[model samples]
Each structure stands twice: as structure tokens, then as C-alpha cells.
Target: MGARLDGTVAVVTGASSGIGEATARALAGEGAHVALLARRRERLEALAGELGDGSSVHEVDVADAEAVARAIADVVARHGRLDVLVNNAGYGSMTPATGSALSEWRTMVDVNVNGVLGTTHAALDHLRRAATGERGIADVVTVSSVAGRKVSGPAVNVYAATKHAVGAFSEALRQELGTDHVRVGLVEPGLVRSELTEGQGAAQQAEAEQELGLMEPSDIADAIVYMVTRPRRTAVNEILVRPTEQAR
Candidate 1:
């Protein structure tokens, strides 16, 4: 039998590293042609090389609305159809609001909130069109955080706010797109060892150091693949994945 996503095309933002990279690889494994989107051209090129002919790289900053729109248009123009979009590009700066630089807060809002908004908006029409085609459905999966569900601590003040914004946006999008057969879902992870958590001093790492073992990017990737591969009648709207030991 053919793979579940054979003949489909998928776009994964922030594909240069971490969860985004893993998701791109996972989607390609399911036979979807993957479009790798990120700011680091060299990293994207390396990934594209690894994924071979099934993947293409686009150097883009998701926070830039125009660039994001162009990238999506390029993907559709090249592939003729778009089936999945993984909004995984994000920025995190964990510090008390009083001590944090205003620039850091602005960046968090741009990449975390604005990025999701622009990418989703650019792809909505195509996703809706794809829903009416052969596969009968399309998917929009945004990688959020456990902070999105609840504020874990003071250090995550603005970061938590951005995630909360994404959660609200995803829910509204889900309600609007369900009837169109375009599934909108959010994957809220607790602590994953990635660029965002490794050296960045993200609050999640401190939580992990307290004996809450971290999850790998692939774990979240698996959840995403599962969400999009379900039978057409199923719509996995929101999945919150935390480490087995993470309490809050």
C-alpha cells in the first residue's frame, strides 16, 4: 500500500532546527514533499540535501508577513498544491518583565505570535482549496507550548502571553475551518531539548533539571504526524505533551 501522505505537499516553518526539523523529516517519511522554511539558508540547504529530492528549502523569517506570503506562494506555485503547514517558527526569552529588554519582548511577540498569524493567513486559501481536492482534507499544525495552556512561572511572562495568543488564535481558526475540511491543531509541548531550551536558559530547562526528564523533538513530531494522518473524519484539535514528571 502507498504511504498515507503520498502525493501531498507539506510546508514546515523553522525547519532549520529542533522540532521544525524533526517534523519536516517525519512528514517526508510519510511521502509528503516537504518545503523547509527558515532564516538560516545554510542549515536549510543541508537539511534539503539530507531529505533529497522530496524536500525544498526556503530562506524566510516567519515574522515577516510579506516574506511568509511569498514563500507560501512559491511553495504552491512549485508544487501545485499545499496539504500541510507546520507553524513551528518561534522565539523565546524567559525573564521577568521588569528585567527583560523591551527588544526581547518585541521579538517574542513577532516570531511567536505574528509569525503564526502571517503563515496561517497566507496558507488558508490554499489549504481550503486542497480540502476540496483528492485527499479530501488539509492540515495546519502550530507548535505551541505548555505555557500556552497556563503560565508556569514569572520568568515566562511575555513568552507565556505570546503562547496564550496562539492558543486563542488556533481555537478560533479550528472553529472556522472545520466545515471546510481544513484541520487546525496545536501541539503544546512542556520541555523539549532544542535550541529554544538548551543554552537559552528557558524556564523549561530549569524545570527539567529538577528531575523532569526532557522530551525529544521527535516525540512532538510523532504527535503531529499522527494528527494529520488520522482518518478524514477525525480532527485532533489540541494536544498538550508534557514530560512524564512535569507537574505544572
Candidate 2:
């Protein structure tokens, strides 16, 4: 309930819905001015409206490197600094290797891997600069998944690979930025009730629900808030959260 982020500026990618949307709201609630970025203009606008005065909305596809850089620059130009960056934008498809189209794999790599790179690269300077301010810290929280830690199943082959890549990327960034007080962290979440999971068939959905109890977006949002709100000297490197009933 503490306003640890009061007067800070936070940018959350994939903010149109689910974890991204919830994270944006949570950051704003903690008194951070939030910039919401997503491909869906309507959803971003609606969320911005709901967050009231300290929120700005931008429609952007994270996979577009140039566009992402420009958007991040614009946010810094307007807010003067970016204290937090949440790379929550990602895509997934559950197709086996044998029958899967290369296009699906490419999409996952582009959005899940390259998207994180693009957004993080653009925000790095801003985050580092923010760290030198009164708070003495800045944060980069990337929303990975359980898949990043392990291959849950065959259907998640390429998806898992993409997440794993980002995991490595996060660790490297953490090491490099630690000295600068820019805390780089990763959040790996298990099955959640979102647009991605809702696409599964009824049987799959029910099975997931029965096993994992279906996490709400707010669950992941809370984790993000915890990571960013840590004391200036403490950097929460990683968090892997799963449903109580989920074993894998």
C-alpha cells in the first residue's frame, strides 16, 4: 500500500490486456506515472482512462524495433525519465515441430525475443539516468513464463526456446546493470486465465483449470509490483510463480 514509486514514470509493453494491463494499473496505483503500450488502441485508451490522470497510452507493436525505440524516446521526452520498464509483450502458439509452420516459430521469436530486446534497448539509458535520482534505483521487469525454466510439453517447443533466450538475456543484463543500480529481473508465471490460454479447447481449458485453478492477471501484476518496490539496495533477481495445484 506504500507509494514507493510516487512521481516515477513506468512503461509497460503489451498493456492492452491481461498481465500487461494489470501491471500498468498496479504501477499507477503505486503512484508511478505509467505509459501503456500495445497494438490495440481501444484497449490502451480504455485502460488509460481507467488509470485517470497519471497514465498515457500508445499503440505500438513491440516487434517493430524502430517504432518501439521512437515510442520509448517519446515517453522520456514527455516524462523526463523512465524509472521502470515492464517487458510484458509476447506471443505463443502450440503446434508440434513436425506439422508446425515456420511462420508460427518466426512470430514467437520476433515478439518474444526481439520485442524484449527492442524495448529494453530503448529504455536502458532512461532507466540508468533515473537510477541516479532521489530513489537511487530503476527496474526492468520482464515477464517470462514457466516455459522459460523448462520445456513443459512438446506443444511449447519453440515458445519455450524463446522464453529461455530472454531468461539468459535478463541474467546478463542484471550482471551488467547491477553496478548502475538498474535492477534487471525476470518473472516466470505458470498457467493464467488470459487471451492466450482462452484459445485452448474446452477440454484443455478444463484440465488446466482443474490442475492450476487459473490465475487472474492481477496475480502476476502483484508480483511485478513486489519486484519493483523493493528497497533501493535489494534487487529481486527472479520470481517463478505457479498455481498451488500445478506441479510443473
Candidate 3:
């Protein structure tokens, strides 16, 4: 038998690293032709090579609306259909509002909130069109943070706000697209080990490893795979994943 996603095409933003990279790999494993999108060209090229001829790379910053739209269009033109879209590109810098840089706040809103909006908007027509195809359904999965659900700690003011905005958008989009056979979902991860966390020095990293037992990018990737692979009649709309020891 063929793989579950055989002949489907998937576009993953932030595909150069972390959860995005892992999701690209996982989706490809299930037989989707993956389109890798990120600002890093070399990393995306390397990943595309590993994913083989079925995959392609498009280096575009998610913060640029026009660029994202053009990239998505290119993916469709090359692949003939778009079955899945992973809005995984994001930015975050945790600092208390009193001392936080205004630019940092704007960056979070641009990449986290606006990026999701632009990419989803660009893919909407294609996704709905794909739903009318042989598979009979299409998917949109956004990578969010536990911060999106609640403000768990200090220094997360603007970051949390941005995440919350996407959470709201995902819900509204889910409702709006259900009748179109487009499944919209969000995967909220809590404290995963990725580029964001690797910035902590070795000493701090070791301490965090001992304390939280950080989840790997593949863990979240598995959740995404599960969401998109569900039968057309079923939809797994939201999944919140946290490390076993993570309390918040």
C-alpha cells in the first residue's frame, strides 16, 4: 500500500530548523512532496537534498507578505496542488515590557502574527481547491506556544500577546473553513528544545535539561503529522504538548 499522504503536497514555513525542519522530514516520510520555506537558503537546500527529488526549497522571510504569497504560489505551480500548509515560522524575545525594545515587540507581531496571516491567506484558495481533489480534504496547522494559551511567566508580555493573537485567528479560521473541507489546527508546544532554547549557555542548558527534560522538535513534529493524517471525516483541531516534567 502507498503511504498515507502519497501524492499530496505540503508547504512548511520555518523549515530550516527546529519544529519546522522536523515537520518537513516527518511529512516527507509519509510520502508528501514537501516545500521547505525559510530565510536560510543553505540549510533549506541541505534539507531539501535529504528529502530527495520530491521536495523543493524556497528561501523567503515569513515576515514579508508579498514574498510569502509568491513562494506559496510557486509551490502550487510546481506541485500542481497544495494539500497541507504548516505555518510554523515565528519569533520571540522574552523581556519585561518596562525594559523591552519596541523593535522586538514589532518583530514578534510581524513574524508570529502577520506571518501566519499572510501565509494562510495566500494558501486559502489552493487549500480549498485541494479539498475538492482526490483526497477530499486539506489542512492548515500552525505552531503556537503554551504562552498562547496563558501568560505563564514574566518577560513574555509581547511574545504571549502575539501567540494569543494567532490562537484566536486559528479558531476563527477553523470555523470559517470547516464547510470547505479545510481543517485548521494549532499545535501548542511548551518549552521545546530548539534554536530558541539553544541560546542559553551550556551551564544553563544542562540545568534546564535536568529540570525540565526538554522535548525535542520531533515530538511536536509527530503531533503535526497526526493532525494532518487523520481521515477526511475527522479533524483533530488542537493539541497542546509539554514535556513530562513541565508544570506550566
Q: Which scores higher on lDDT, 1 or 3?
A: 3
Q: Rank the candidates by TM-score, best first.
A: 3, 2, 1
lDDT of 3 by residue, 1-248 (tens): 99999999999999999999999999999999999999999999999999999999999999999999999999999999999999999898877888788999999999999999999999999999999998999999999999999999888899899999999999999999999999999999998888888776678778889999899999999999999999999999999999999888
Q: Compose the digit string of candidate 2's lDDT tens values, residues 1-248.
A: 56889999999999999999999989999999999999999999999989998888888999999999999998998989999999999999988899899999999999999999999999999999999999999999999999999998899999999999999999999999999999999999998888899888888898889867988999999999999999998999999999998899
TM-score of 2: 0.98
State in Å the error of residue 220, model 1.
Answer: 0.4
Show where candidate 2 strays beyond 4 Å: none
Error of 2 at 219 (Å): 0.7
Q: lDDT of all the models against the reference?
A: 0.93, 0.94, 0.95
Cα deviation in Å at residue 153, candidate 2? Answer: 1.3
Candidate 3 accuracy as TM-score: 0.98
Which pairs of residues collide in candidate 2?
none
lDDT by residue (198-231, candidate 1, tens digit) is 8765674776767889899999999999999998
Per-candidate RMSD vs. true structure?
1.6, 1.0, 0.8
Q: For residue 145, what is the lDDT in candidate 1?
A: 95
Backbone-clash count (model 3): 0
Supply the global lDDT for candidate 1.
0.93
